[model samples]
Target: MAPLVWLITGCSSGFGAQLVHSAVARGDKVIETGRNAATKLKHLEGTGAAIVDLDVSLPEADVKRIVDEAVKIYGKIDVLVNNAGYGINDDYRKLFNVNVFGALSVTRAVLPYMRAQQSGTIAFVGSMYAWWAPALLSVYGAAKGALRAIAESLAAEVAPFNIRAIDFEPGFFKTPLTDMAKIAQYAPTAQPVDAYAGHRAAMGGLAQALIGNERGDVKKGVELMVDVIRGEGSASGRKIPQRLPIGEDAVRVVEGTCKNALKVIDVWRDDVVGTTDRDGFEGEKDYEAIVKGPDAQV
Candidate 1:
């Protein structure tokens, strides 16, 4: 097959950068963009990929301009990697702008082209928080959760058109982007009274360790993603879950979650669907209808 044309957002750093390298290594054509595309990914020149500036939250017209440029260059976009996003310091609004609204805008821009071509993949870079909610990141979690829902429903809507949607939820990866504290979006304020001291401490410990620690192998993650895109025989026009839970601790948590999910299903099987009808009178003679039949009269 001909080399796939990949349009990746937020190629400045982390997964996007890694993925660009991986794709280029495989001889794929990549149109990588970011908020500071001119700055973030300067080295992409020799990597057999192109770079451009893209702020996902910009106006619809601006996003359309990007779509136009991309289509002009590549003829058609084979894959749309919606990886340009960031947390905000302002709790809800800023996060919404970058993460949720911007993502939607970009997605909407390319959707027309994808549908027209009748073949494409849109991968939303979601977070594990979208599934397992954590403290202090409620707004960010909500944004990702919304994106996941969008991907899920959009899949059903676009399936007939042969457009695939994938929600790539990566657990904590070590990168400059992982420096949540300095990002202006995550500066913590004073705590409330009577907090669960132990739990709060534990959660904080986990957060720092996961976000701050340099553990994830970017190369490995990117390789897995490329595999997802190239792997033949995958369900066409459906969500390809490259839901990578990086790190050993994340692995344990995911495993335990899987186990618990199975146990809960087993325990609630009867309750969920019921084995039999309750011991109630089968006939109306036992308990007459609160509102009598029309023929029964006033």
Candidate 2:
């Protein structure tokens, strides 16, 4: 197979950095973008990867420029990794702007090229919190949840074009992104609330402990990702999961959430079914009929 061209966002650190290394090691061409690409990513300059200065939080025009540059350099992008995101404490707007909207913008910019080519893979670096929210991390989790929702819908929409959407749910990885000093700078000052004091303390403790001691290995995770993208190695002959959990903790969280959700649905099955009016009542059934009718818009 010919070497693939990869365009990855947030390449300064964490999964993005590891992914760049892995991709380059496999002889794949990479366009690595980060806010501090000139300095932070300087070490990768002679590694045959093009470095682009890109801040995902920037406007659409900036994102388009980055995409254009990537295409110009690599001819085409075979894969796109949206990996720029940060956790903010209680600041939902800020979190949503960078993690959700920024990623969406980058994906949108890359989609036209991928669609024209009729083949590409877009991987989103999401988190386990997207599935199971932990204390004090609700804002971050909500942003990731939105990203997951976008990836799910996008997979169906672009299937005909052979463009694949994948979401990587990572759990507790030790990286600069999880550094306490950096997190504290990005995180808003915690407000004193009597009722949630204990929960807040517990969350703080978890963050501190996991900062430099996370169990997930970045190198191994990126290796799996590369294999999955190539449709060989460990992922050969297996259906690619739309949501790929990257660690033991992520797997547990996703499975546990699914199990608990199913249990709830089972418990409420009778009541849920009873909501429909059975006796020729115009309800959701009528709506379904209309939706399934010939007049329904595509």
Candidate 3:
């Protein structure tokens, strides 16, 4: 088989950094992008990985330049990983700007090529928080939730073109990106209240609990992603695995939450399926009349 070509954004640190290294280690050609490409991920150049400066939050035209550069150097891209994201503790608008819009911008930029080839894979580094309700991480979860929804819908839309979308839902992985000091601005603030007087306090407590309980290893996390990329594991999809939960904790959360949510869904599953048209009538014309209204003009 020919070596796979990968284009990954947010190569500065965390899973993006590890993924870039892992892909290069496996003899795959990698093109990594960062807002500051020279300083962050420049180390990958020593491993023969191409580094490109790309801001996923930029306009489509700018993103096109990045994609064009990748195609120019690599001939073709086999995988596109949407990984450029940051967490804001308070400035959720900023977080959404990067995590949600930024990711979509990059995804859209590379999609035309992937669609034309009809044989490429797009993986999103979604969070377990997207599936599970982790308190105090609402903004981050919301952004990831958007990505998850997009992946699920895009999976169906792109299947006809033979393009696969996968969501890598990983639990917390140890990385500098997790620094509370750095991401403090993204956290919610306290305000005087009487009704929900302790809400902010409760949120802080939850954050502490997560810090104490969550188990994440950068090496292990990246290895799981590599396995999925190589198709060496049993976690396969019918068309494509729309979502792959990495780490034991991630799998546990998905299974548990889904079990509970499934019960609720099972109860109302029939209600969700539209059985009849809104216009319940004796004839097609009658239905049309009902829809249009009797006294209304066409």
Candidate 4:
């Protein structure tokens, strides 16, 4: 098979940087991009990966132009990793801009190229927060949730063209995004209510304690992603699912959330409304399964 061409965003550090290395190690071409690509991704220059300067939050025109230039480097982008993102506790406007809209803008630019090629994959680097919400992370969770919705819809939308979309939910990875210290930047801007001060302080203390102790491995996670994208290793012969969780903690959260929902539904079957007007609606609708289609079908 020809070497795949990968374009990944937010290559400054974390998953973005690790994915660049992983894809290159697989003998694939990569266009590593970040805010200041020349400087931030200097180390990847001689590794057979092209570096492109890109600020994902730039105006749509600028993002499209950058994508066009990156596309020229590899002639065609076989895979795109939407890995650039960050989380701010309170500066959610900026958070959504970079994490959500930025990803969308870049995805929009690349879709045209993918559609033209008629064979490509787009992987969204999402979060475990989407499955299991955490304290003080609602804003970030909302962004990831939106990503899941988009990824699922997109997977269905583009399957006919031999394109695939995968949304990966990674747990508390050892990325800078999990750094509790960064929260201090927004401290002055926080508007605290006296009623929840003590509880909020306790949560803050817990977060501070977990700063350097996160267990997720960025390299291993990226390796798994690359393997899945290439259908190699344990992923061999398996049709990649529309959504996946990267870390063990992420898997646990996704499972727990699902089990919890089932338990609630089972316990409150009577109160789950709309049952009274069954009106020949006999069985449960496996709508998600229908919408997702069989992996083999894709």
| Clash counts for the predictions, in order | 2, 0, 7, 0
Q: What is the lDDT of residue 215 in candidate 3?
A: 82
lDDT for model 3: 0.78
- Give the per-residue lDDT of model 2 (tens digit) for 1-298: 7899999888877788899989999889999988878898887787788889988888888888878877899789999999988776566776787798889888998999999999999999998988988777778888889888888778878889989888888887788778878877876676678898898789788777777788888998889988988777888876566778889989999999989999999999998976865787655654685445232111
The model with the greatest TM-score is 2
Which residue pairs in model 3 clash with each other?
88-186, 89-185, 89-186, 89-187, 90-185, 90-186, 90-187
Q: Please identify model 2 stretches exceeding 4 Å from their true place.
A: 277-298
Residue range with the least summed lDDT across 10 consecutive positions in model 2: 289-298
| Ten contiguous residues with the weakest lDDT in model 3 | 289-298
Please give me the total number of clashing residue pairs in predicted model 4. 0
Query: Which candidate comes out best when scored by lDDT?
Result: 4
Candidate 4, residue 239: how far the Cα is off, in Å: 0.7
Q: Candidates' lDDT values, in order?
A: 0.74, 0.84, 0.78, 0.85
RMSD of each: 9.4, 4.3, 7.5, 3.0
- Pairs of residues clashing in candidate 2: none
lDDT of 2 at 166: 83
Instruction: Give the Cα RMSD of candidate 3.
Output: 7.5
* TM-scores, each model vs. reference: 0.77, 0.90, 0.82, 0.89
Q: Tell me how candidate 2 scores on lDDT.
A: 0.84
Kindly list the per-residue Cα lDDT of model 1 for residues 1-298, writing each as its tens digit. 6788998888887788888998887788999988877776787767878777888878878888977887788788888888877763554776787788888888888888889999988888887677666676678889888887787667667779988776766666676666764553565454634566776688668767777566666777667667777663332343355344445545665677779988998999888754565677364563475335222101
Considering summed lDDT, which 10 consecutive residues are worst modelled in model 4? 289-298
